[model samples]
Target chain A: MQKDFLELIRRASCELPADVIRVIKQGRNAEANGSPSRSALDDVIENCDLASRTSRPICQDTGTNIWYVYHPRSVSQMALTRDILAATRKATRLAYLRPNAVDSITGKNSGDNTGPGAPVIHFHEWSRKSLVADLLLKGGGSENVSAQYSLPNGAIGAGRDLEGIRRCVVDAVFNAQGKGCGPGIIGVGVGGDRATSMIEAKEQLFRLVNDKNPDPVLAKLEKTLHAQCNELGIGPMGFGGLTTVMGVKIGARHRLPASFFVSIAYLCWAARRASVSIVGGVATYSQISQQALKYKLPAVAARKGR
Target chain B: MIRIELPVSEKDVRKLKVGDEISLHGTIVTARDAAHKLMVEEWPKFVEPLLKNGAIYHCGPVMKKTGKSWKAVAAGPTTSIREEPYEAAVMDHYKVRFIIGKGGMGPKTLKACKDVGAVYLHAIGGAAPLLADTVVRTKAVHLLDELGVPEAFWEFEVDGFKGIVTMDSHGKSLHSALLRKSKKKRDAIIGI
Candidate 1:
């Protein structure tokens, strides 16, 4: 199981999921042939291919190692956590992950990627026989640009309603610009406390980029915000082109009347994440976008005579 | 694709303007939050020679130890904004010619680019593996024991390392321009 966990980290670190690759290619195609946006996406596609082929990390940052684990009653949470930490340390030693955990108070690195709260894990007991773990490597660059807004704020003229939610998200994207690494996938959370709002927002990122929300209202908001963000002309890397974002995912939770918090998680084009499930000693990894791995942009392929 | 060698002349960098795509070939140094802070706070003299007319990349790379030396696995630009407070001072003190990073710097850094004859080259953030391939060799390392691998000053010889001139010596910034344009659009959408 630990070996399977290590492989999960490797795959998540080195490979861009297929859907992310597809949207990036779409973003590139939307730009002019010689535009900077197109060229940036070209570099991204090339980087994806190189990282996966070499089994190197997709980005040097490697990001916060977040884990969402689900297991049956047969498994022990303590043992699972111990194994995960051991695997994280091993991954860092292998260069699959950079040593990211820092001691905030002491201003010292843990040397390994583990500290008091590092490699944050949330475990849930499930009725299923299989044990599942999903990992997300949320890069610091994108995390820096993520925003949260409290409603009834006069700054953006937002109130505690859906209209206010739209305003908050749009404002966050605008402020992020290219700094969040444009052509971003936005995950929005509405109607929770500040902390839970953020978690809910980040959780939305675990969904496939093209997946629609079960709630029609939230889905509609997602579609609307998606188009609105791209219309800002931020483009890829904020170079000014047709595409600014590849997807917008929104999730909502019931909140107290006194507080309406909206949190935005801006995931970069890298979007490093993967999942694995083990049942009866047999482990299965989620399928990465193999089609994306082999894809070469037409213009680039033509120039290189591939 | 404008190509410039590292240790570039101010005259060559002056010719670069906003929106110009560039490829740098030569020695470049990696420095992020901790390094930048140290550069400004302590005014490290050792880095002056390397940074003078040379480039500083805002990066924290995944590196593997190969015997006594190190090899970069994934080296990509990090967000440059966090270094905003310390950048201008470092650029002025070191006479650094190029700052390769993502996102953009603040107004002081923009002003310092003109005053110090530097330009902010915006590398594609998250495009690490491809960028790492450009590294010819890891030349040397400093402050490794103090700052750890990610925040240490890693010197590398690179060929065809690429970025866009988002901020130039002429007092222009592609980032600010995009921000202004995007702000208006955001206001319109939010009805603010």
Candidate 2:
């Protein structure tokens, strides 16, 4: 309750990580100067950096976050919801993110980054003392293409196999092409109720690119998914280039085997947002907004090709 | 660099080829998703006065305030294919002869361009700050209060609005041709 939601929002909005900044700049420079001025591999890194520092959003579409609060109890859920939104608006404004919300039916702009029933916050409680709120700052480009299919056991026979997920992700991103501001990251949520699987798919984003899933099988899926997504050749900004997905992440849960949903949530390179002060009564939490990341952007030109 | 005029004849548009960059001047209509939907379905009667073989820029500008006036900052072209469903109708209905946007439109729009003597130009994406420089002045801005500046029609006095020819009246598209050529390179990299 003590966490200042407004301050948290401001922090989340205005700032982003140096690495993210570095990559977005990389993308912008790649575009401005690509061989029409450039090369594919170099452009990918450049766009990621340009998106970060040009202070222009990595892509103009700085997406909506589908926040999931896996709370230990109901006591803090109210503040939990309030805190994240406050943080979302603040971080969005500061990041120089574009205002992207609009009424789907009426075509009226929401004016702020928010509107009615927006930033859908789903809460679940347990006896544990801590609160962990995971946010997926879902961008419109990729989100437009998020696919969920309730495959018959035969369709995805192994509960979840690498090929199906690969096809799903690659096809998903490929379909997005220039729409999702490509060179996106796709998260696959497997083995849950339809909605939960979708929710968990987004959670994988909090884990960062190239991070391994504790489950070794899921880890393999991530690697394979990452490789295949690139194979689509959607490329950076869909200019017949390479390095489409920086990585693919999967979040899995063991659910009743009778029913399963392969929920895939897509995130563009500009995966923006911050989490500060996940609380449990007297216990406190700090934050992980990209801007708060205390590392310098690595020069990966030499490493990019290899 | 090619220079094209409005209401170009099919023979003239067909003379242009993909990869030939051009600077276009003269009257062009501006529209995106909202304006596109209206024009395709049934645009307002007032809109009739606006269309004259004009260019449709797939943009929604982020504006800034200048000393005494307001100016667009980042006005780069957005992906134009999103308007594919309504593109042909808008082209034929309003006689929109040119489409300037990033990425390219699909087959139907390409066909319409060829039949209607139009061309789809591919401007560089993410070059908004630079692209914003070509816009010299805007005349008779409409719908600023209704659909916001972005969805509104901003007729401009542009000089050297640079764009690459993606699709021409002969039904050619650089975006597709680039993909086919690159796919072989991508496939060759496979195998040990």
Candidate 3:
């Protein structure tokens, strides 16, 4: 189980799924030939190719480890955490991940990429017998541009409704310019307190890029925001071209009457993510954005695999 | 388009204009948050020789040890704005001619570049593998034990390393110009 999980990290670091590659190709084709934006996208495509081929990290930062795990009630969180930390340490040694976690005040790296609150794991109990774990490697550059807004932002004149939400989202993309490494993906959380809102925002990124929001209203907003953001001409790496955002995924939760928060988590084009399913000591690996049907389950003996 | 070689000459840096595409050759040094802070405070004596009239890239590269040497697996430009506070002082101290990074710098770094005849080059962020291909060799690394992999100062011999002159020695800044233009457009769209 540990070895399979480590392989998932290695794969996520190196290979961007087919869906992300598809959108990037679409953005590249939309650009005019010989334009700087086109050239920038060309480099991005080349980078993806090389990273995947060489089984190297797609970006240097390699980012914070975020794991979303849905497991049967029988599974132990303590065991999972232990295995995750071990896998992370092994990954760091293999150069599949950078040594990212640091002491906030002392400016010390944990070296093994394990420390207090590193490899953040969100575990959910499920009725099913199997366990599913999804990993998102959110790099630092795009993470830096993520923003949260309080309602009635006087600067942008954003009121506390969907219309205001649209304005705020557009403004966030605009302000990001070439910084969050656009053409980027935006995950938005419409409600909740500050921390929950940000978590929900990041959680939305787990959705496939091409997937529609399950809720119709949010779906419409997502579609509208995607179009409007691309209109900003931020293009790839903010070189100014046709595409700024590759996709926008919005998720919502109930908020307190006093608070209305909109949090945005911007993901770069690398968009590295993968998932694994463990059932009865057999493990099957898959990528999130790639069409699930396309992957044939490669089962490994969970105990002996490690 | 321009071709630049490091340690870049003041005359060559002066010739670079805002918005010019450039391909760099020779050697460049990589530094991010930790290395920058250390460089400013300690002003490492060894770095002065390497940085003088040369470029400092804002990068934390993904490196692998291959046999006796290290190799840059992925080396992309990090966001440069974070180093804005120390950049001007470092530029002055080292006589560094080019600052290579992404996301541009602020008024302080721009002023420093103009004053010191340096330029801020914008490489495509997230194109680490593409950039790594240009690195012919990992020349050396400093502060590795203290700073760790991403924060360490890595020197590399590069060929055909491409970037854009976003902030030039002449005081023009393409990043600033783009920000202004984009803000106007954004305001119009949002009715701000």
Q: Pick the candidate with the highest TM-score.
A: 1
After superposition, candidate 2 runs with Cα above 4 Å error: A1-58, A66-99, A122-136, A153-160, A274-306, B1-15, B21-30, B45-51, B64-69, B123-140, B148-150, B154-164, B174-192
Model 3's lDDT to the true fold?
A: 0.86
lDDT of 1 by residue, A72-96 (tens): 9989999999989988999999999
Q: What are the C-alpha RMSDs, in order, of all predicted structures?
A: 5.1, 6.4, 4.3
Tens digits of lDDT, candidate 3, B79-173: 99999989999999999998999988999999999999999988989888889889999999988888988899899999999998888888898
lDDT of 3 by residue, A1-306 (tens): 688789989988999877788889999999999888888888889889998998888888899889988888988999988888899999988888988899888888988888888988889888999888889999988999999999979988898999899998999898788888888999999899999999988988876677666568888999999988887767787777898999898888899999999999999888998888888888887765222222221232112221
Error of 2 at A240 (Å): 1.3
Would you list the C-alpha lDDT of every candidate in the order shown?
A: 0.88, 0.60, 0.86
TM-score of each: 0.95, 0.73, 0.94
- State which candidate, 1 or 3, has the greater TM-score: 1
Per TM-score, what order, best first? 1, 3, 2
State the lDDT of candidate 2 residue by residue for B1-192, as single tens digits: 899765455566677877676887765556888788767666667666566556788876555545656555445666688899998887787677678876677889989988787888876554444455567766556676667656777666567777777788886876676566544544333211
Per-residue error at A125 for model 2, in Å? 8.4
> What fraction of the true interface contacts does model 1 reproduce?
0.84
Model 1, CA-based lDDT: 0.88
Docking class of 3: medium
